[model samples]
Target: MNAESSVGAQPTASAPKRFALPSPARRALLRAGLTGAAAVGVSTALGAASASATPTTTSRNRPGTPDEALRELAVGNRRWRTFRQRHPHESPAVRQSLTSGQEPFAVVLGCIDSRVPPELVFDQGLGDLMTVRSAGEVLDEAVLGSVAYGVLELDIPLVMVLGHQSCGAVKAAVAADESGESLPAHIQYIADRIAPNIDRTKEGDARVDATIDANVRAVRAALAAEPDLAAKIATGELAVVGARYELSDQRVHRLA
Candidate 1:
């Protein structure tokens, strides 16, 4: 299904305008100019590949707008939760097409939790998304720069900072903050990054869940404020969002 139809949720009145794809000229110029500006980083990200091997034809045509990308994700999530996944873009031709290069439509920054793999949760296929993972969906220089490469080089329309229900990283942070014990090594680093986003006033799983949402929001805000990503947002070429995956229901919910 096309992104326009896959929106199982109701679309906003102004949403149509937001989903409009950039013109061919605008898209090309955007690819050229932004690619040049971020050439070093993009080159670092794609060492041997020649730009994006993705042609603008056929069904593999990635979503062209933030809303459309979001809608497609929502639809894919629905398919996942319902056990109706189409499993799109896994074909041999699609695989061969991507051998040239990739042009992902969205950047999904998700937790390293085993239960919440973004591709399966979103029911997307190869080359459909640029997936980055860290504990608690935490951002490090490498993680953030990887996401930025997708946006600045690939002109990806959406960036989703995906948190999840019962996030273990956030739980560790909550427990560590409560017990006054430091997590060891890089685990401590993850907890430290997550701790500030938690509210120390609450207790138990409720606290951890709340902190999970908070971390997603904080990450979303941080990415939105990033200079290069923010430039794309200002021009209406990109959107940064927060979402949560529920382990029990096997559902992904966009955070309000």
Candidate 2:
């Protein structure tokens, strides 16, 4: 879905009521590193909504702010981990309605790992989350531009970089770096982007794991620092966060 498209009916239905998280819990999440503040200066510029309230329905239930977007994702991930997914917005009516226009709540930049599909991992459906995937969560002009389009054009409130435990891209990068071997074709491009941020000192799975999180953080920082997105973040209109998904436990951990 192109947020830049100028032709369509933009729905103005107020975002639906969602699962509200209390203040103390929100503070605990902050401390626990489930979110970062604007997530760096994120705490200051925000408007009054501090709670993590999540949506429970179709596109009509838009999450209008960063906290709301984060809340819905948290709820979706929880449903995924607990095996209680609502599978919201897969209905034909929801699909048909989206044909006229789209108002997604968040933009998710995650790894291309088959196991870490953004929609399934977050338990979101069509028109709910705008997704962009690259191996190891690497960034490039096109990737950055896609994210910008969501925040600047669609006014989407959140951007999340999801890195999972035991990511193969990071694993491959570590292997290549350690062996002094070069990756072939476009794979080398991916490795080169990740090479600087990779923690080569750690061995075995530790190195790959560290790189996985590091790559996510790097991507998160890059998106947060993008000039266009930074302005919206200043007004509390958007937020960029880093998270790690543990495949073993089926839980998604938000990073600090």
Candidate 3:
């Protein structure tokens, strides 16, 4: 079993399509809230729009400007690096509140690596961030739809592609590309996703770190090319940034 096995055995070729839906009770509650709040001014109505939005697999914490959201994530990561995790509320009140809905501040499309959990790295509590994880941080139709929900339905301002150092998947891709090793179908799938970027970054002086950075850039580019995300970014409603976390430092550097 590799690092991604924990996220569910490399989503088999026949892996069932996952779907997300809000609890009926929660949907009712949110609908009620929206109806009540819509009577207010346009600004207030917009605020309630996010708060009362139906929960989906891609739920966000709240509405914020791109810079504000980025700052919040950066500050959270600082706490994590220093082992000063705020360990915020995961209380019954919080759970019950989200029972009605969520308003996450940012959307994180990241790798499924256990060490790079978004909530912990960002020091965000329950209902704080909309997170999507995949091996190598690769994307497909469903993942794009998930990101779209974050931007269109949830009004999240920032979409981050979180990569990490010592990424085993990246290492595997580098090995397979170099040695022409026949990887298992599952591992091969991940390798294929990351291989092109690895090749592009290589000058016959490739290293795992370089490959990992390349993977980050590739996924970031993929997100940028997403039509829904592109439109939101063009309109200033969202920003997609690449980030790589250093395991030793536990700090995430924003890729330029």
Candidate 4:
């Protein structure tokens, strides 16, 4: 009453109307904002982690030693054998990463048999392996040069001579040797290279199988003996191994 009397004679209107949220409502709004912000932060962190987890195909990140390279191949083959292949390094990003250069870990000299394609059998994608193929894993000047380049120039650590079971080239070579039959000019060249690997004492499929295994070992020995490669082997910087792929079981068995 005293305050009212002090005001001007004309009755003062009530203070301007005001509105405010309830305390609980205000807290709810604040919590919602904080939750949204936290979600954004979590998303960013997860994105970074995902990026880090993906493999990169750069030289710095490539396998550093022959054992490391061989381990990768073995794991990949295990996946392939188990039907769980990850099929790594085939994405667009992987392809782009290789534009600058390549650091293949291994050189695979395999048969030209379609079923034994090195990339598929090993479950490796592009830029992971330097592959050379010839009938019955035969090595010619060009093939040897290619492998040499991978070793001497590119510094590939592992050289794998991959043979396969039930190889046609081996069978043909066995036939040519047994029948004294002369194959066509180019075919004869392949047969000639493969014939020496066959064991004449073994007959039929036994002879063919023996030839395939012998061919792989012979090629590995030859590569290991190469002057440039020999130094690397002696220094423990390179390894030459023979492996055989079984078509029926889809497995790779190391022969040496």
Give stretches of model 4 more than 4 Å off: 1-60
List ranges where model 1 is wrong by over 4 Å: 1-59
State candidate 2's TM-score.
0.76
Write one digit per residue (lDDT tens) for candidate 4, span 1-256: 0111211111122211122222445545554554456556757876321111123446446776767877778788888989998788888877667644567888999988999998988899888889999998888777886787677656788888899999998888889999999987799998998776778778888888888888777777676666667678777788777789999988887774
On TM-score, the candidate that comes out on top is 1
Each model's Cα RMSD: 7.7, 16.0, 11.4, 32.1
Which candidate do you rate higher for lDDT, 2 or 4? 4
Clashing pairs in 4: none
What is the C-alpha local distance difference test score of each model? 0.77, 0.72, 0.71, 0.73
Q: Higher lDDT: candidate 3 or 4?
A: 4
Q: Which residue pairs show backbone clashes in model 3? A: 60-103, 60-104, 61-103, 61-104, 61-105, 62-103, 62-104, 62-105
What would the TM-score be for candidate 4 when compared with the true structure? 0.76
For lDDT, candidate 2 versus 3, the one ahead is 2
What root-mean-square deviation over C-alphas does model 1 reach? 7.7
Per-candidate TM-scores read 0.79, 0.76, 0.74, 0.76
Q: After superposition, how far is residue 56 of candidate 2 from its true place, in Å?
A: 17
User: Compared with the true structure, what per-residue lDDT tens digits does model 2 show for residues 14-125?
Assistant: 2111222225455345434522332344346643222112232334768898888887888898899899988988898876666445678989998888998889878999
Candidate 3, superposed: residue stretches over 4 Å from native = 1-52, 55-63, 199-206
User: What is the C-alpha lDDT profile of model 3 across 1-256, one tens digit per residue?
Assistant: 0121111011112212233433547645655665456435534745433334655334334447777787788888889888899777487776666645677888898889999999999899987788999888877666866776667667788888889988888888888888998799687988887777775545443577887876776677666665566667777777877788888888887765
